[model samples]
Target chain A: MSVNTTQKKHKFNVIDAVILVVICAVVAAAAFLLGSRNAQSEQNSVTLEYIVEFRTIRDEFVDNINVGVKLVDASKKYSLGDVVAVTSKTATFIGTDFTSGQLVYGDYPDHSDVQITVRSNAVINDSGRYVIDGGYEMSVGATVYARMPDYTGTGYCTQIKEIKD
Target chain B: MSEKNSAAKASGKKLRLNIIDFLIIVVILGAVAGIALRFGVVEKVVTKSSLSSAYVSFLIQDIQDESANYFVAGDSFYSQTHSAEFGVLQSNIQFLPAEAYINNEVGELLKVYKEDRIDVRGVFLCEGIFTDEGFLLNGTSYIAPGSTVHVLSSTIDVTLTVTEIDAVGAES
Candidate 1:
């Protein structure tokens, strides 16, 4: 009787061990799949910094211009209104001291230099350069426009300069 | 003699069971770690960079029916070229739209993600420097007060005059 009990206990122990191992294997597999998916999603998205310059055509004392802005590809289908994500760190303004009443006069004021740093995600080629939807390399002076979220009129006013990703 | 043999067998079984239990625990812990790593809960430490803050405002027009849902606080606004920029930093409507009041003095304060024309104000944090134009936040230039900012939206174009700018200190 003792031997029989011992043998039965051993059999139950084996079954429990098998079940535990199987569960662990399943869990590990699931985690691995989830991790792979997360990595792939990260790879599909790229963050890039774009250095933009905006010059004031006229001079007026303004406190600051705080609005949603974008750099669009003018020569491509993007002209129909497509935008990229400008990172908070890169979306900014630079130029004359507005607080002191410095104005941009003449053709373009010497202090009228407005440098905007914009960070966005674009389809980068294997060479790691930004390309439009048609896979055209974003060239220097490609007629890019600085568009704002203006609900009343045409928003494209400033052209981009010195774009460096 | 048979009783002693049986006792020995039982002890061996216990030992084996303990080993299996330990292995199971290890596997479980590993699985948990994997999940945490994937979700960024157990991120690796890296050097931190500096960030700056600025207060900004926008005069947005009436929202169209289709795009009304995208104007809520916390909703990210990207440029037409897929560049993520301003986020909806503030909205008058907190819990319910009916509960909020619109102040016309500061322009029509509208509920977030609602179809209305209103003036929205918020703050953004980014890397910038103090330049001749004003305080350069990110790459956009902030001019002095009274300057006209031509805002171009998909549906309409509007202009907003700069009112105020307060740049916070530089800290990591």
Candidate 2:
């Protein structure tokens, strides 16, 4: 009896390999392009919220409470942005006790102190104080005044105390 | 060897290219080349027609009496020099006041002045693009956060420190 043995050889396909390499290259190129686009956008623009807090030197009461008060810079020639919102809290202090049989001099009471707290958002400007839209200067100890809308009474008579991001 | 055996050997050694495989290669190459060409052709278009709002904060330090003349605090600040052509867009500044903590229990007004730096916050709408880094105003490139910008004023030399940058329509 004769024994017949057949050998089989494995063949590598060059076309399949080339296809895979092409796919990988395409994916890599796409990723690079998109990544660069994102990076470019990042270096372009940014948005921020500007917050500022000020206090009223004297006691004030307003009907609408949003109008009349304006923030001024140190130059006293320019005006800050419009007062977006104002948060105020009034506190009364009694210096002398009101007796049942005592003479009252002032309108309400002699021993009373009023404190006002206000936080507002001003107009947004570029990254400098050179030419603000309203053209105002803002800084610490920058004297800011608040005027009454229509009623003839004292408004905000104070300066800026604290500023935050 | 027989004639049939020789024919089988010849067939086994012959290289065969399928039609489907060739078509696939051509399609893939075409698509990739198309994409690359498109990417190179298209330019990044920045819309300058619409206006976007930006919020910013900064500090003005050591304001002297002589320079204080240029610092104006009022309803609006109209730049006599700028605001015409070749200037920043319409914007405004709102001076933030310090907080006063009063002890209502003792009937005393307690005010604390910490730093000499004046804190200012502003909101402005201009033709610019919003990006991850900061707001970029059109027709200019100098304005950016953390950069000290100087305003040309007659009385005083005004300098500002950009502290923060926030884009409009983004989550704060």
Q: Please, what is the TM-score per model?
A: 0.25, 0.25
Q: How well is candidate 1 docked (DockQ)?
A: 0.07
**Separate clash counts for every candidate:** 51, 38
- Put down candidate 2 lDDT per residue, B114-143, tens digits, no spaces: 343344444433344554323544422223
- Position A61, candidate 1: lDDT: 19
Model 1, A36-150: lDDT tens digits are 6456445644544445444432122111223334443422324222233321211212224345545322222212333445445445555765544324445445334443332
Model 2 misplacement above 4 A: A1-165, B1-47, B65-69, B73-126, B139-143, B153-156, B168-172
Q: How would you encode candidate 1's per-residue C-alpha lDDT over B1-172 as one tens digit per residue?
A: 6896777676764335655567678777977987776544543222234335555443333333344344455443433322324323445422222122332232333324343334433332323344432443344433333333554333433344433345554322
- lDDT of candidate 2 over A1-165, digit per residue (tens): 322235454454786677768776777897897776456445532221222433232332223234335433322324444454555444343332234433323222212232234344433334532223234434444344432221112233344433554
- The per-residue C-alpha lDDT of model 2 at residue B62 equals 43
Q: Report RMSD (Å) for each prediction in the order shown.
A: 16.7, 20.2
What 10-residue stretch in candidate 2 chain A is worst by lDDT? Answer: A146-155
